[model samples]
Target: MKKFGILVVVFIVCVAFLSSYANADVETEKISLNGSTSMEKMVNALKEGLEDKYPELLIEPQFTGSSAGIEAVLNGTTDIGNSSRYLKDSEKEKGLIENIVAIDAIVIVTDTQNKVNNLTTQQLIDIYTGKIRNWKEVGGEDLPIVVVGREAGSGTRSAFEEILHIEEQCQYANEVNETGPIIAKVQSIHGAIGYVSLDVIDETVKPLAIDGIQASEETIQNGQYSLQRPFVMATKDTIEKQNEEVQKLFQYIQSEDGQKIIRAVGLVPTSNKMSY
Candidate 1:
């Protein structure tokens, strides 16, 4: 009877140890990613691909704006920070490394009913800076041009304004907080014109040609399209210094399989031999 009791106690201890080890393993498999609403589709696609490839791995993503995402990674709260624009000098000073995984075009969009099909670089600058207030000024109808834009700190907004040299000069009638709402607002309004990531554009809104160059993989890759920006997955430290799961995520992003996923989502992968 004494021997049996001792054997039962040993068995219980072994089971408890195994359970704790299993829980720890599961926790280690999770990789947290936060940032860039613009990169949401690409990140989600990569998340699904990674999970499918390594069933034990889990990718947790949060679609806070790009600046917030950078702050999260800087504060050690996330494994990756997705930014549609390149990191600023101030951000780079804080030890964050910019990893350009893909190039994204910031396409200007308007309502489907709008007659305007293109805008010269100067015309785009004039329109956004409040110089051209009527769509008729740019060969559209006589309706008042409603400027739709992303809120402050958005990567898409930052890139759009910077590329046009109209930062802080935009006469925005409606400032939305996310990319989806910009698309929705532009779709619903007759004179609404906005900019969004090229990957996110759908039939809901019509994309405009900038300076006679349509936003496409070829135009953006060849420098013909000037409204493009880098899709950055930022890290506080080098990939070699990150944890196993974080390292694996970055590795997969650079792999051929990952490049396919990037292209599949309408983003131009860095592997396309284009200089960033």
Candidate 2:
């Protein structure tokens, strides 16, 4: 009887140890994503979908602007960097791989109270370049145009400036940090005009048709939207080289189901392609 009791106790201990080890393994299966405030909606959607598919896995995300996110991945601090803009040639030369997951339109927004509904590409350029300062000049109210923009190191700002070919020449009256605040700032100020990712568009602000082209997923996919940029999920190396959890993430993002999530979140899905 004593021997049997001891054997039972040993068996219980072994089972408990195995159970604990299994839990630890599951707890450690996490993928950390950092970067791009503009990609918040899509990232959160992907996180929810990925976690639902693989219950044992966790996705950690931090929206610390595009530049900071890219730096975090390059320094080995994060598994993936979410960039709303294309990776620069200099960044690619440093072993960062660009995985274009989606395309997002950068909508030019103004206060809903403003009567202006369309802006030519040159008019937008003049507005940000300090050449067009009054709303009346653009067929709006007599209020002065409050040009709002994203802060430095922001992927949205980088892409917006690059697309306009007006790098470092923007005359912003207010430099907001995130997409939400930019929208709020534009909505509150009667003459404010700002740019934000299309996914975040709400009824509070009016989206102007750029050169008679409205920003939409269809327009972007069909190559009619001029103010669009790639939504990149950058990795330090190739997907095959990443750990199992990270590789799983890339695989899911490339899957048809993942494309559904992208579309659901208002981002245009891209081909399953990666560039270094």
Which candidate has the highest lDDT of all? 2
- TM for candidate 1 is 0.89
Write the residue-wise lDDT of candidate 2 on 68-125 in tens digits. Answer: 9999999999999999999999999999999999999999999999999999999999
**Which ranges of candidate 1 are over 4 A from the true structure?**
1-28, 271-276
Consecutive 10-residue window with the lowest summed lDDT within model 1: 267-276
On residues 1-276, what C-alpha lDDT tens digit does candidate 1 reach at each position? 999999999999999999999887774389998989999999999999999988889899999999999999999899888898889999989988888889999999999999999999999999899999999999998999999999999999999999988899999999999899999999999999999999998998999999899999999889999999999888886777888898888878889899999999999999433222
Model 1 alpha-carbon miss at residue 85, Å: 1.0
